[model samples]
Target: MAEITAAAVKELRERSGAGMMDCKKALAENGGDTEAAMDWLRTKGLAAAAKKSSRTAAEGLVGVAVAGTKGVAVEVNSQTDFVAKNEIFQSFVRDVTALAMDVNDIDALKGATMPQGGSVEDVLTANIATIGENQVLRRMKRIEVAQGAVIPYVHNAAAPGMGKIGVLVALESDAGVDVLEPLGKQLAQHVAAAFPLALDETGLDQDILERERAIATEKAAESGKPADIIAKMVEGSVKKFAKENALLSQPIVHDGKTPVADVVAKAAKDAGASIKLVDYVRFQLGEGIEKEESDFAAEVAAAAGISKG
Candidate 1:
């Protein structure tokens, strides 16, 4: 048996696009022959992942998990919505979300160890091989509050805590968890429904605001008004834009009339606690990812090695 160096495995993986472990095993089995290892990977169908790797995986669950004052949201995307319904996929998302509670970002979460005895990336690779689709751990966010609660909510959940949309709302206060949990949940749900861009008008993205301002200016110019009037129109439009996109200024989803800031104030007063909505995170599955459109029949023909008519 020939010695299989790390470089050999790396080369094989690069050539075959197979998982690290698989590449290692292939190299070992082939006595460190790179071409043979590639053949082995192809024979085992593991090479299929490489072909599918470029496919857009925009459908999967957005999972949320909360641990005491900390909460995390994760989005795991797959090539098709059907994979989101799979029990194995759901379990993976649930476990990954739980694992995310301890990690600060997507890179750390990917490097974190899964409960099932592998690194998150390793397990994800195994899932892609077994599940027969390209899957990606797209993004994650963590929110924590020192005194209040970090609440989680899932919208259109395929399973508890796993869904197409996941939200985390962090409230800061000296209030009891019992009092804060329900309020946090309501706020989380509102986040999922309203899709606020920021916690307040001040937090809104400057680029986004500028884009809105430009659109408002264009509209105002079309009004055939005086320069001062157009300036006022643009300012008013920008203000309305801020209010609509800011969580604190937006109307609460439940009442449709009360501003979120007022609702939080009222909730705090009713509980006799000073609750402050601090931060929030909302992950909507496939929100920004662009899915590839392909010809199904041509894809089948190509996969079958048949020439097009």
Candidate 2:
């Protein structure tokens, strides 16, 4: 029996687009023959799945799941929005979001064994092949509180718990679920609509603030005003940017007048419960992934084995 080397496994993985472990197993089962290993992966449809992996997957669903005080949000991307409506694709997103409640990150979620069988990554590969499109298990975030409710909201749900946007609001308080759940849900809905960058101004990313400052400086400089006035203008611009992007400072989505901080405070006062908005996560499907463009007619003709005149 020939000994399988790391290089051999890597080559098979590159050639077949199967997981590293799968490639190694295939090589071992095929007596370290790369050609036989490729054939093995092809027989399982993994090769085809791998081939599709290169395609950009910029449309799909964001799913949210909550269990008691813990909640999670996940994004799964596909090459086309049509797959977002597929029952199988929807199920995958729902299941994965639930799985994320226990896992810490995307890698852990992928490594986790699904209830049905096989790892999450295995199931994703199978889905890619069977669904006939590139798919990505892009990201997952989990938020939990020691006490209180972690409420979930899905906007424009394609299916239960799955949608184009998923938001989870973690409220830590001594309040009963009867009081906390509704408040949390309201905040979750606000989060989905407002798309806050952070829970407060302090939580906003420094890089984002720096970018805003640079732009404000450029705009202020164009006014040809005195340096002190320009400085004041830039300061005002940065502060406004922070207020608009931060969750607590942003105006409440429902009321359009009360700031979120005041809304939470008022809700706490009304309910007679001390509620703290601990954290939040909002996932918009394919928010950052870039989609690829190609000539559709020429590609269709090429696929049909026809030459363009």
Model 1 bad stretches (over 4 Å): 1-57, 297-309
Extract clashing residue pairs from model 1.
Answer: none
Superposed by TM-score, candidate 2 places the C-alpha of residue 275 at a distance from the truth, in angstroms, of: 0.4
Q: What overall lDDT, based on C-alpha atoms, would model 1 receive against the true structure?
A: 0.84
lDDT score for residue 102 of model 2: 88
Compute the lDDT of residue 40 as modeled in candidate 2. Answer: 68
- TM-score of model 1 vs. true structure: 0.78
lDDT of 2 at 292: 61
Model 1 lDDT tens row, 201-256 = 99988977776676577666877899999999989978987888899998989989
